[model samples]
Target: MAQLAVFDLDGTLVDTPRAIIETFSAAFGSLGVEVPDAPEIRATIGLPLQRAFGDLLGVAPDDELATRGVRQYQIHYKELILPRAQELLFPGVAEGLAGLQDRGVTLAVATSKFHASADALLSAAGLRDRFALVVGADQVTHPKPHPESGQLVLDTLGIPAEHAVMVGDTTHDLKMANAAGLRSIAVTYGIHSAAELATAEPTWTVDTFDEVVARLDKALTTQDQGSAV
Candidate 1:
């Protein structure tokens, strides 16, 4: 049986915070609202756009203004953000992904970004076709930290939670992975620091994608050897 490797897109595989922030700022500028500072924008990295926008704009969510904000953000994101593929994939990311794929592991992406935007980024980063499944915020009713997205990926990949592992860069990812009963591995190169990620109590915390690959390789090897016993 193949193991499932799920990933978060924005901060994990691709460093898209700058593009996201600039696009959101442009969106707010269009709406005549004050643009949030970089730190404020980065803090909401893993949330759905409505929640992120509401938090950053200091407006109540589920309101008419938040609705408009979501709409405007989408427009600005497509126009301003989608074109900028400035964020490079973290070191060893492509190599690690390829290595996992070569080992017959099923890989997927579960992110809070909209499906279209996620696709665009992955494509731009040369990672779009590598994934077996892609679950986006728009694809699920409940986004991450809720486990719905992870569950959706597992269902799509026809894998059980025990055979799956989630690799991400935030407590949100760790929470979702834990909620879904999958082992979560946190990467330190993203928005959250190691200390913040520690709060999520991830199965492992890695500083680089290479370390992630190494840990995953060890886990897979152990599982294989155990099954043979």
Candidate 2:
């Protein structure tokens, strides 16, 4: 069976903590609301923009202020953050992704970021073409912790859940993967703590992107063996 590997963009492949913090600050400033500090904002990294903004603003996702915050965030993110945020791929990401491609894994991104921003940043980093598909928050009706986004990637790749793995840095990713019935691997170098990720009970947890690649290889091999039986 063909193996599919799904990834989360912000906290998984790249470290955008500064960009996220500044963007939230700028958006909140523009909207005349109190902006959350970096650590508070970091805690919400893997969630959709509306949800993150809502949490920061102490409002519901559908609240008008939250909606306005999302709009302002996109504006500032594209105009100010995107251009200034450096090519910030986490260490070993390029090599790990290349290794996965070399090993014949079908790779894709399933992120809570807007598709346009995700594409722009990936292209700027020269990593856009590596993924066969890029599923974003705007592309799905529901975001992480829901199965829709991962399921969309699997459906697009035509890969079964058993043949897929979701690699990310938060509980949201693990929860989504679990809901989709796919194995999950959590990385520690992003926003969440190893303890927080452990609550989700992922198939594996690693400290580096290289370990993620290694685990994927082992997972596929295990699947092959199980199938052979």
Candidate 3:
């Protein structure tokens, strides 16, 4: 059986912080509200859209304003993401994914992005077929830092938590991996700084996609020998 690797989309596989921050700013602008600071908006990248917008707008997630913000952000982002999808992929991602698959690693994506949006970008990137499954916020009842999405991916792929690793750039991703009983690989080149990611205490930390692939190669080889994560 192949080991499973679960990845977060934004900040992990895709360098989307700039786009996301812009989308958030534009959404608030459309509502005639001051945009939240860029860093503050970036900090919400791993959250569900409604929650992210609500946090930035200082409203309840279920409030009409927050709901409207989600709609607006989606409109702007969907329009902006397609043409830029392949460019947004962090360098070496496609190669790293291929390497992992060659070594019998099954891949899956778990992201805070809505299902259709995630599909669009992955398809545009020509990387959709690499993943055995993709679980977006809309595809699960609960999102990151909660483990529901991670568990759903595991369940759907029939992979046990112990045989999987979750790679992500945010605390939400690491925390979800931890809660889901999977090894966590924290990547620092994304939106969150290494210092911030350290607080989550990932099983392995990588600074680039090359490092990620090398680290995984070592880890999986060792795991195949019945030791290490």
Candidate 4:
């Protein structure tokens, strides 16, 4: 069976913590609220914008406020944060992705970011054409940890959960993978610490993108050998 590798965009593939922090800070400043520290903003990286903003601001974000915040963030992001796309691509990310693609493994992105923004970032990072499928938060009725995004990607790729693995940097990714009955691998270099990801009980945890590729190669090799036997 053909293997499928689905990735999370923000912390997993791209190190967007700095951009996100600055954007959120600008957004909150516009709203007359003090911005939190980078670590606090980074912790909410994988969640949807509204929830992330709410968590950072320490209040329940109504639709209007959330929408405004997102807009403000986008404005700031385009002006100041977007130019850092080059810096956002983590080390070994491009090589790892190219290695997977070369192996004929289907690649896809399932992210909580908006589709257009995700596309722009991927394009800027030179990974836009790498993924055969891309599913953003706005494309699904339910977002991460809900399984819908992963399910949609699988359905779009015409692949089954058994032949796929979800790679992300957060417990939210593991939760969604578990919900979809797919194996998950968490990366230690993302926003979440190893201890936090351990709570989600991913199938594997690795320190780098190259380590992720190594683990997947091992898993696939073992499965191939087992089938031959």
Task: Please give the range of 10 consecutive residues that has the lowest summed lDDT in model 1.
Answer: 220-229
Task: Give the per-residue Cα lDDT of candidate 4 at 190.
Answer: 85
**TM-score per candidate:** 0.91, 0.92, 0.94, 0.92
Candidate 3 lDDT, 1-229, residue by residue in tens = 5688899999899888898888788888888998888889988888999999888888899999999999999888877767898999999999999889888889899999898999888999889999999999988888898989999998998989978888999999999999999888999999788889889888888889998887777766456322323
Residue 71 error, candidate 4, Å: 0.4
Q: Candidate 4 lDDT, tens digit per residue, 78-192?
A: 8765677867788988998899889888889999888888898898888999999888888998899899999999888888998888999999999999999888889999878
Q: How would the candidate models be sorted by lDDT, starting from the highest? A: 3, 2, 4, 1
Q: In model 4, which range of ten residues has the least summed lDDT? A: 220-229
Model 1, range 127-157, lDDT digits (tens) per residue?
A: 8888988889989988989999999998887
Clashes of each: 0, 0, 0, 0
Candidate maximizing lDDT: 3
After superposition, candidate 3 runs with Cα above 4 Å error: 224-229
lDDT of 1: 0.83
* TM-score for candidate 1, residues paired by index: 0.91
lDDT (tens digit, per residue) of candidate 2 on 38-104: 8898888888898998888898989999999998988888876566434678888888888889888
